[model samples]
Target: MRPAAGKTATLFKDTPLALDGGAMLSPVTVGYETYGTLNGARSNAILICHALTGDQYVASDHPITGKPGWWERIVGPGKLIDTDRYFVICSNVLGSCLGTTGPWEENPATGKPWGTDFPVITIRDMVRVQAALLDHLNVESLMAVIGGSMGGMQVLEWIATYPDRLHAAVMLATAARHTAQNIAFHEVGRQAIMADPNWQDGRYYDTGARPEKGLAVARMTAHITYLSEDALTAKFGRNLQGREAVSFGFDADFQVESYLRHQGSTFVDRFDANSYLYVTRALDYLDIAGRHGGRLSDAFKGASHVRCCVISFTSDWLYPTIENKRIVHALNAAGVPVSFAEIEAAHGHDSFLLDVPEMDHMLKGFIAAAARTRGLTGGTGA
Candidate 1:
């Protein structure tokens, strides 16, 4: 199955893409989707970076899943992001298995998919590719760059690396860096993938078999982290699955187990296991502070000119409110104008992506204020 349908793909040749790991891809490809119309001066463009397991189909139907856009709640003509007033765009990141060139892409040298041979990439690398896409689109600057979770990490990198390219930035349900616990959780997922006998050292492709089982486990493990314990209890708890009592055997006896098994099973359909490994590795290496001599505030020194918002969810233990608040504190220390909010959510890290009215209102207000400052209805700030 193709990674994307009706999406735009750009092939950039001649110019080598220098990765954060000191490797290069001379003819990297990017897959992206855009909505609404770009204003005359391109002053009303917004970039919506997506989280892991998400694609460029931000405001469109998923070709594979047949589900409405993941953020359909926020980006329609009359929604919070208002397609009527802004030209919004989303792109699959560099190392994703989507339409973008990734581990599944053929390696000219080996005459096979890159697989484990794909060079390591970072959040900064992903943002750099996005910067290139903006150049290709002729959007000299953006009204705002917004993201959540892994996507938020990309936004943070954008502000740090290309602060002058965007007028405002929003990072929701994220932190300046991954905590030890976060890395540990990811490690478990990674190990689950590698442990699969079918992993075949990441070269499972064209082998007539794939590591779907391992990939499912990985997705299942990570999915649990995206939810709060309260949410789990409310949604499934110890309830039996379509039965009055336990099965006594290990066949998804509980509703929660059955739910997770379904989640993992469906995930393997649309996502590639190798891409999962590559993307998770990139996340594990996220160290915004480390790049700036171990000081988070220093990472945003040049972002003082950008308007910023850092949001967190009350139940999101994956990257808790305190971790997100640290980012706000760093932006403040860097003298940037910023907003901070911890929405009372019961869905944990996934709260930002869910139908949270408080988050909607907060984002609407911030974006509206930023638009006014941007003169969205009139002359370009240029």
Candidate 2:
């Protein structure tokens, strides 16, 4: 479905901003939706950053897929995000295709789609554009910045780049830097996209030749990381798809194979393959600590005004609990007020996007506590 005429007003209001990566982007737009009221002071603002492949439709139904927003379970009128109590804003990141500046956007210079011309973007570049958007909205500071996965990386960047701009931060199931193994997975996805003949070197716009197979394979590979081995085993195991026994053929004889195929096919419908390449590359290039002399604590140094909460899921093997622990240790060493929790869940890395009772409770408590500390409500002095 196409977006309404005014649906993307805020996102597309501004023109493309040049990036530090030496790329000129035009007609750059961000797709976002806001919830609740900003209040008289505008101090009740909460920014929600989305993970890779996630768009700005956090609480509302998605425009493209017609499915409920990715985090609708946790971000609604009375949900954990509590739109009734705070103004919440979520936007598609710079390198995304969901109404954001990306490979799919029209290039003014050549009067064509950017495609491969869309220069490589870093996570920091994404944050820079987000800051510009917030500035355009006249939001001088934020009550809290919350995110998971790549979203979590942006949350860290916000605090590090704009230390005095946020009152609190909540990062869930994320890491400070991309590991070599993570980069390898991303490389595999990129290779899959490039290997497809239909990709046509990223210029298949008018050829009606989309790299669907390649994009699907890439999505399938990445989806596996979002799930745990145990979860996969329990869900599919050695079961066959609708057959009592294996077909003994190369087709999707296994239940797991069928499930992954479904995932890939549906993903390509809503996501652009080139955008996938750009966003995944951005994730691979993220390194918060590296910008701070390789000391994670240094990243938080002098940011005493911001309180932080780090959460990890036990089954999340992608980011893992140890990753969250390291972030907590760094925050503690920086003398920053922080809280850490390891919630027990069976959903693996994607648990943060799913419904987990303990996670909801923790978020409610953390946001409430952080708000009080920041003097958003009447409680102990912030």
Candidate 3:
């Protein structure tokens, strides 16, 4: 039952989706992409959740940027989450601007973009939407759910909300809840966007204007958090930007500054400022433990039968190994079969997206091991 390659599933059309903020959202559209076949038993499905800025293009070309999908290296015909033997699914999550219901989308009530009016969404809400997407596709269960960073938050939510819907989960560089530093960084980004006069309280869509400067600054700031000091040193260091000496001006004097400015400029081209605010706020509000009486273990009460593999990088202070350990501890308290790995890498929080041989090998081995247990074929992953 391999569905069409690109499809968007509509849900909450008749029944409004109950949000954590007590507001109901109707006519939620989920944009998604599928690869390979669902297999005879419908037991070969693998859901790949994307990070904050990612969309539905997992193993294909991005429509907006015309660049290869973010995870093309790890997800393809022979990649780690190989599309050859597994049916792969990836969706643009709610509160995201990429072909999904988000702040930039129109609100039926006011006939304008939701903007700041969009109800605050949480990780659980995002997971619920994905579950609905699967239901609409008639997929009862998934062989494995995989993600990293914010995507990993959704993976953890899946374990809490629909334990029986998936057999295994691979969580990388994430935590069960948002740390103070996480919220702080997100708040800074939000402040930067809101400070721009062009933002106009997120109502610039009609005026044909955008908060490009603010959004670019926000992206520049957040991009720093995604990397490590060691990686930064190795990549750029104190190298001057196309000059032998200092500029003695505000221009990019160092190569790192130039690179960051380039990153900021390019990011604003494909992302919406309002959507950035909503998504970051959603991530900051992710507190599975607080939702379950402040006990992280309580969130996994019904996930005893689920298998989990948690991985973290040594240089990833944004979502450090300590955070992953806390999750492993909670899963252990819940008697869930879980494996944890701490890879030594200098790429920081973004290590999972880079070409780290150890991560590639680990994912290939872990996916293969899970596939074997589920009676699925296995082959070498890229």
Candidate 4:
């Protein structure tokens, strides 16, 4: 039951993972990574849920892409998440292809990849598996749960599903539910993958012919939604790619087009098309209010004691500040301890991961206050 800190770890469960769509997945396997150390009280643990396309390599280099961990900016030693002071645990969420049980993983019963046949999972289901992982590690409660974007949805699910398991929660650039625009964007991505003839109906695994073009196209479409119009204009305007005049060809003549193409091409190398479909579907299906009988406050009924912090970026239209305010309002109605902040940033939804000193200061202050209440020291732990 000891945590396999630093390296990848797995937990096997004989029971089944109940899905919202009324299906059961047995022999569940959860892949995770841990940072820092667990103190004697074991109450210093912090759970970080990753956003879409993010993996377990939170504070370390990704083994596949060889890129620095996505959140390395704020989770390392002496940083906001301070690995030296908090036992940080991050897992490749269920329905994700990165070392977790997902469409890309083998189905225990069929001996083949689940692919499109995988049961439709929800954010709550993802949180359930994480809870099981904590149970295996004997972590009865967490100091805090933090996430942004899709990761933020998971944080809300965690608070709702395991109300008393965490003392504080930080949700950044997220919403309580997906909007029509969100669903439309995801549908476009799904269509892109399905339209690719090489997909072979989600059986492209091990096949020499993969739907790389479709997957890349899908990534390109989704990547645009991750940034703001202001950021896009600032980074890549209508400026031509190379020559002074327009080429008048379909070839990426614009700088923005070239940038998006690069984003798509690189994405196909590391992501599975089927996994993307499943995860986006999960995102679209996330609705805390729907799960709680059309009452968002009902979702937080049992979490009244848990402190909540909601963060929204000024330019994040994907999950705008209005959406975050909905959560805060619900928490207020539910009588839960809550705080809200709207930070001004030009990067849009991706601002949470960028260099935002304000976010860092806010996170540090929140965690420090929470640590003091938990009787934990401020400096690095032994």
Candidate 5:
């Protein structure tokens, strides 16, 4: 069960997908990467799910950005994830741009980009595809499943859909469902994309025009949510970018504006506009409770074998501590062993992506405990 020396393919030819909406998806593919060695018992497997705008390059360099993998700080040989002791596997979620099937992929039927034709997916569907990929990899069970943000949604879905398949779970900075406000913000981004004339009804490929402006605006809007008011104020509040005074024109007169603009511009180069629409739509549609008769506890009722750790940040208004508490409460009622932590941090939803010493300590301890309970060795400290 060890990973090969070089990159390998996990997708099969013309895979069939049974959609929740009763539609059929032919020729499905998933992009993924594996690191470390699975022991003879195959009991050391860990799955890492990525958030929105994240790819499968968990410990390697990003092919497009030419930067270190997004989670390299927390993963690798001796990092928090400890690839030396755990066989870690990460996959680009279904409906993503990085080598997974999405709007950017060509539609076999029309021989054009799927674009608007791409079927709307749910978190459950994404997990389903991941489960299939795991099957392809010959992994019968997982030691743990860990993720944050949209990745966290996948983590929750993993536990619900395959309760007995994983020994433990780690969910960070996420929610069981999208709130009305969350949907509203995602709609704003979708509107921005559609408003761009270059979008061309989502058939922009033939036109050779990219909705860079609109997509950048969308990225700017979402990036704001990834930070806290305090962070924004501390980083750039009323400050001008290389200018002593604010410009009277509508151009970026403030440092914050300039920073956001840069973020948006850089994002478009590596991301596809239509993929943003599809992935955000999946996030908006995520609701494990709604699918389980409006009770969050019911979703985990059968997941008694799972030991879970739920982490939240103090300043994360988007999927705040209260939301995570609700999840913990549900796990408690379901009689699942769980640990809940609301760490003190000023970084908001992005804290999980940053190097928070407290979070690192908590995760190291929790993961070690979970591994010990599952009869694995080589435990690390808090």
Candidate 6:
């Protein structure tokens, strides 16, 4: 579906945005959406960083899927994030295919899609682009920044690179670095995309054919990591798909196989194959500790004043409770004020995206206290 008018705003700048790959990206374009009002003091603005596949539709109906926004449950007039009390902004990241510039965009010099020629980007690069966007919006400092998974990675980069600009941060289901197993899983997805006949070395744009099959496999593989084994088992246990008995063939006879197929097929409709490769590569390179003298505590040393809330799900093996605790430990060592929670959940890393009563309440309380401190509510707001 075509994008609805006014749902998103794109910012274009002719100045150069220095990339970590030692290249200069000029004429940068970012797609973003904002809700509620930026109060007179502009002290109530919150930034919501999206996950790997999310876009700028934080609390609105998505243009493509016609579904409610990804975080609709927690971000609305009377919800936890409370749009009535705070202005919220969300943007498509640097290498995203949504409204942001990415490998899928046309190159002015070559007059062709950038494809694989797009500069390799890091989480820091993505955060840098976002900082530029904030500058354009005249938002000097944020009241709070909230994110999950890959979104959480960007939050870490923000605290590291621009500590003074952040007031509070919320990190959920993420890690200080990608483990070897994480890299291995992403590598499998990357190889699947490259092995597709239609990939054409990432130059398939003009051919009118795409690596949908390969991209689907990649999405399917990554989706597994977002979920827990117990959740999968409980949802589709020994169940057959549209049949009374197993087909005994290679076809998708099981319900779980059919579910994965659906997830893969639908994903390619809105995501680009090359963007997948680039974003996954960026995730593999995430190392908050490595970038700061081989110690995670050093990563947050500059952000001692920033209030932080770190949360993890018990079932999230992708970036388990242990990984999240490491973040809390680092913050503690750095003398940063932080609260940690390991919510008892069975849905795994994706739990942050779902309805969890404890998470919702915890976030509400934390954000409310932060808002009060920022003079955005009660007598202070008046």
lDDT, each prediction: 0.88, 0.84, 0.89, 0.87, 0.86, 0.88
> Superposing every Cα of model 3 onto the true structure, what RMSD results?
3.0
Candidate 6 lDDT over 1-382, as tens digits, reads 2233233434445667788889787777787889888889989889999988888888998777778999999888877888888889999888888777788887777989899999889999999988888888889999999999999999999888899998999999998799999999999999999999899899988899899999999999999999999999999988999999989898899999999999999998888899899999889999989977889999888999999999999999999999999999999999999999999999988999999999987888889888877877542121
lDDT (10s digit) by residue, model 3, range 1-382: 1112257888999988898888899999888999988889899999999998988899998877789999999888866777888899999989887777888888999998887889999888888899999988778999999999999999999999999998999999998878898899899999999999999998888877899999999999899999999999999999999999998999999999999999999998888998899889889988889988988999999999888999999999899999999999999999999989999998899999999998888887888888888777646532
| Model with the higher lDDT, candidate 3 or 4 | 3
Q: Give per-residue CA lDDT, model 5, range 347-368, as digits (tens).
A: 8899999989989889999988
What is the number of backbone collisions in each predicted candidate, taken in the order shown?
0, 0, 0, 0, 0, 0
lDDT of 3: 0.89
What TM-score quantifies how close candidate 4 is to the native fold? 0.96
What is the lDDT, from 0 to 100, of the residue 214 in candidate 2?
A: 97
lDDT string, candidate 4, 244-292, tens digits: 9888789988999999999999988777888888889999999999978
Tell me which of candidates 4 and 6 scores higher on TM-score. 6
Per-residue alpha-carbon lDDT of model 1 for 273-376, expressed as tens digits?
A: 88888888888899999988888889888889899998899999998999899889889989999999999999999999999888988898899888998887
**lDDT value for model 1:** 0.88
> Sorted by lDDT, highest first, which candidate order results?
3, 1, 6, 4, 5, 2
Cα shift from native, residue 120, model 4 (Å): 1.1
Q: Would you give me the overall lDDT of model 6?
A: 0.88
Candidate 1 clashing pairs? none
Per-model TM-score versus the true fold: 0.97, 0.94, 0.97, 0.96, 0.96, 0.96
State in Å the error of residue 223, model 5.
Answer: 0.9
Model 2 misplacement above 4 A: 1-6, 9-18, 24-27, 378-382
